[model samples]
Every structure is written in structure tokens, then in C-alpha cells.
Target: MDFVPLWAVVIDYILGVVMWTLIGRFGMGLFLPENTSFFFMRFFVQATDPLIRLFRPITPGFLDARFVPLFVAWFFYMARFYLMPWLLGYSVMGMLSFPLEGEIARGLANILYKFQN
Candidate 1:
């Protein structure tokens, strides 16, 4: 269904927030040994760096650089909570009614309505 992709995006955003929160609360040291260049860390760094870079400039430096991840998480949550539903609603309205479209739209509308509370 059309809303499936939008739901996936919402899930990804939630995962991103959780990932950032954990990393921000506990620095990489807890997860990786010092001086260890594990493949997972490399992968995580690659996945998160662009987002950190985007937010770094706007973030206040009252705390350590660790806050970057939390800021990114908050940004993702805001986008998910405020922007995603509206975008999905517009997208659904634009599409032709396939057999599954009504069901998908109803599901998405329900999700958005629930989140609004």
C-alpha cells in the first residue's frame, strides 16, 4: 500500500532517534574499546556523521560534542511528529484509488491521529 513506505520512514526516524540517544548518553567508549577500529563503529560513524554535521552548526556548544547526536535525534523526532503525517496525507490524496489505497490511507490517518494526541 502507498502508506507503507511512509510508515517505514517513520520507523526509521524513530530508530534514528533511539540510536542517537544511546550514543549521546553514553559515548562510543562504552560500546567500543579504545583504539579499536571495529567495522561496526566505522559503519555507525558513516551512517550518523552526515546528520551530526548538519546539526552541529546550529547547536549551542554549552555541552560537549556528544550533544550533537541528541540534537539530531530531536530533529528527527520533530520531522516525524510534525511534518511526516502532513506529507503522507498529501501523497495519499494525490494517488489514484487502487483496491488497497483506502485501507492504507485509513491506517496512516489513524496513525497520524493517534500521534497527534
Candidate 2:
């Protein structure tokens, strides 16, 4: 149940990282070349386009092209690392019971609590 959503998020993040690495290192045309079949690029375009499109507006043109993928990757990582635990803790006894969620929450809590103490 919850694992599905968690895995989806993880997979999305991994895809984002891979796409970003490939494009940043090899250039966009490598994935979306004009001379080849359209089908090959479909998955690459779909997975990377949504995030790039969403961020393009707010980001300056100079920075937008280079930073969009990195920003999206960081955003996904933060969502998994910070928001998930906070939301789960806020909902359930200030403690997460699920193993994965619980581990993340405890690790983050320990880090924050250490700074406080």
C-alpha cells in the first residue's frame, strides 16, 4: 500500500538523477536526437519534461537550463528526506512505525535533536 507510493517516489527520484546526469554530461540531443525514431525519446522526454517545464518559469533563462534537473532532484530528495517524516510524525504519535519511514524520521530527528542539545 504505502510501499507502492514510497517506491514510486524513489523510482522517480532515481530516474530524475539518471536523466540529469546523462543530459548534463552528454547534452540533451543525445537523448532527443532529431535523426532517430521518436519512440526512443518518449520516455526520456516524459520523465524529464514535466519537472523542467514546471521549473522553467521561475528560473532565469541563464540558470534555468542548467539548474532545472539538479533542482528537481534535490526537491525529490528533500520531499523523501524531510517532508515525509514530518508529515508521518505529525499524523502518528510523533513517531513513525513503518520501518523505512521510521528509520528516516529517527535519523533526521537525531540530527536535529543533536544540534539542539
**Highest-scoring model, TM-score:** 1
| Residue lDDT tens for model 1, 24-81 | 4436645664345776666556667776777778878885564566666766655545
RMSD of 1: 10.2
lDDT of 2: 0.54
- When superposed on Cα atoms, how far off is each prediction in RMSD? 10.2, 10.8
lDDT by residue for model 2 (3-112), tens: 43565446545644654543542255444553446654555555666666776676566653445566655555555455655654555442323344445678999999
Kindly state the number of residue pairs that clash in model 1.
0
lDDT of all the models against the reference?
0.58, 0.54
Relative to the true structure, candidate 2 reaches a TM of: 0.42
Model 1: CA > 4 A from native: 1-30, 33-35, 89-117
Estimate the TM-score of every prediction: 0.49, 0.42
